[model samples]
Target: MSLGDEHDGQTRTRLPEGNTGDPYATPRRPARGSRSLIAVVGVVALLIAAIALANRGSDTPTGGSDTTGGAGAPARSAAPTAASGVRPVTGKNGEIPTGYARDEQGAQSAATNYAVALGSVDMFQRGPREAIVRAIHDPAVTDGLVKRLDDSYSAAFLANVGLTPEGLAPSGLTFVSRTIPVGAKVKDFTNDTATVEVWCTGLVGLAGEGSTKPVTSTWFTITEKLRWTGGDWKITGSEQTEGPTPVNGDNRASMADDIAKAVEGYGGFTYAR
Candidate 1:
């Protein structure tokens, strides 16, 4: 079949050098559309950083909202507390937030956070990578996911971006891939299974001077079809759509070193409803 050309709105154009796009626009949701998710398995070498500046504060007041996946949903506040308290539960592995999300919103939180862990830069390392795969992905899909990622972050691919043999970030360089859920809504949430859609902005890139792959922020929606397995939510299957995306405002970009320092200094919070 012939591929469709990218209309300014419908098409998701991948940058020729590095991955960059508005993560929140609905990129023509074909049943099997390429979600513009140009995967970031691990950081290989010196790279650029992915930074999602908080525009909610007085500084970031462009009201950078769009109509992509979950449109007109007021927009998740940057504050820590809300009616839905879905904090991260400390786990044996690292941190897995659970408890208090009793409805569809809760389920959405669970699914979104799971996606965060699954899409983290830590997934590049060997041990943590496997643990995350098993943690968030469905058992049936785990093997297939691994195989695909292996191809996606192969030796040649890693070399192009400057990673080590197994996709480790070069020393002193910080690799970041964080998905901050703006909000979530449940189409059908139950005690067992829930379908949740998360509005998210993700940071993907490396941090350092002279880096080719600089950090970039993306706005995208992750519609998670979560299963109530392992005493918590696990992804059965998920689809990604681009946007509720907005224009790249003419904000002054941060310095490369400052970007790295900010990523390191700042702590990602446990999202609550």
Candidate 2:
């Protein structure tokens, strides 16, 4: 979702006059035609050559032997897939995850987890939203940020997105909003401060029979400036931009009921690396 549309205090892009529609349901086109067989073969050859050249000088030893039956070439560094075994937080702050480490990797992990919290549907409500803000944000800025967010999630915005004035989905309808981090990078780092950018994709909207705002997905990047405070990382401020989005695939859209069922069955994750 656009930060201006539903998440943050930035100025929003106004729809054209009288253009009241579900903005998330933008039309999609079929993917472009594929390359010819010969073209594809040539491209694959080039890619193989490039990979071989790139890894030619790597020093890490590989498990397999070379075609000439000599010691194998070096292997590339493995990508991170699990937690670093850093001690985890012992508890939650009103359902917000906490107790992050006080280092660069810890900062990246904190930013990723915090992005999930901030982009969650829970942020649409008052009490959980406040708890989330207090848990993830720096104490120095929490009060002011809470007020800013309260103003941003105005009643008009809530009503526009099919929420009650109190930010609840009407009975029988489930509002789905979740952020899944694809990856995170430390832009800058220091003992007491860091800036991290987390690339994420999300689902948002209302789901139920006869619902107009069927859930839709969005891609965005959240950049957070953080500080080591209270023995862990806390967000000092943050901003979001459209995406590092890729071309859309030709997947068929699911029915609202199926989408709702899938969301309920598939739980979210606690991101760490």
Candidate 3:
């Protein structure tokens, strides 16, 4: 699904703040016997799943980076030019693929990346979100999203996460919701329409101390049915479903101090395809 999140500063988060708190969690107790056996099975499953996804990505011809520059020009690009935001860093959607997104794979990639961008932490900001929605979504969907997003960030909603009418935390809290598109493919494509599923694994939670909303993660598949309009793909209708996801690994959770440090030290990415 096109999951969304925000920082402590903005009031434009996708869902009401209440829905974000204690987000979509379930118990995960290791199976009774044969812990090592279970671990082995899980690791193997993850490896298999990763291989499959990598194959899909490799099969799909994606957008390429075209850099025309004088020496030391910083590439004239604000975002990284990769299909999956180059591994860790920050993982979310970037500006709509400008060129090279012409064919079916390109269309699918553009749609997937657009979805990830639309459902990103930047949407919590006013100027960026409006610009993004206007640029990516068909005109019809834009108005609805604007109005609905306004409501979703209403005073009542913001109150859930201890925000004021302006959707701001008391002092030091940071809201966090970011989606990382693992891979995407178009099940079907046509001149004027396409059905693409962007399988995304993402992190969602609050940053900063004493924040009610803790950072969490989720796996979902955002199936977007798009219509080609104005020379680009736009979402006509979309829905999310349970992921074709693998189980989480047994790595120890990062310490809270580390989490805070990472949040401050690291930066977000610009996704492409």
lDDT of each: 0.51, 0.58, 0.47
* lDDT per residue as tens, model 1, 1-273: 011110011111111121212122221222333222353322111011211111111122011234444655565432222232223332323554444234444465566566566556665555666666676666767776666656565565555545676777678776556666676666775667778777777776667876555666766777777777666667776766666777889999887788888767765544433
The better-scoring model by lDDT among 1 and 2 is 2
After superposition, the stretches of candidate 1 with alpha carbons farther than 4 Å from their true spots are 1-81, 84-93, 98-102
TM-score of every prediction relative to native: 0.65, 0.72, 0.61
- Looking at model 3, the pairs that clash are 1-221, 6-175, 7-175, 8-175, 63-273, 204-216, 205-215
Q: Candidate 3: where is the Cα deviation over 4 Å?
A: 1-97, 162-164, 270-273
The number of the candidate with the highest TM-score is: 2
Q: Which digits, one per residue and each the tens of the lDDT, describe model 2 over residues 192-262?
A: 99998878776666778887666667666777889998888898877665568888899999888888788
Clashes per model (N, Cα, C within 3 A): 28, 0, 7
lDDT accuracy of residue 75 in candidate 2: 51
Query: Against the hidden true structure, what lDDT does model 1 obtain?
Result: 0.51
The global Cα lDDT (0 to 1) of model 2 is 0.58
Tens-place lDDT per residue, model 3, 116-138, is 55555455445665676666666
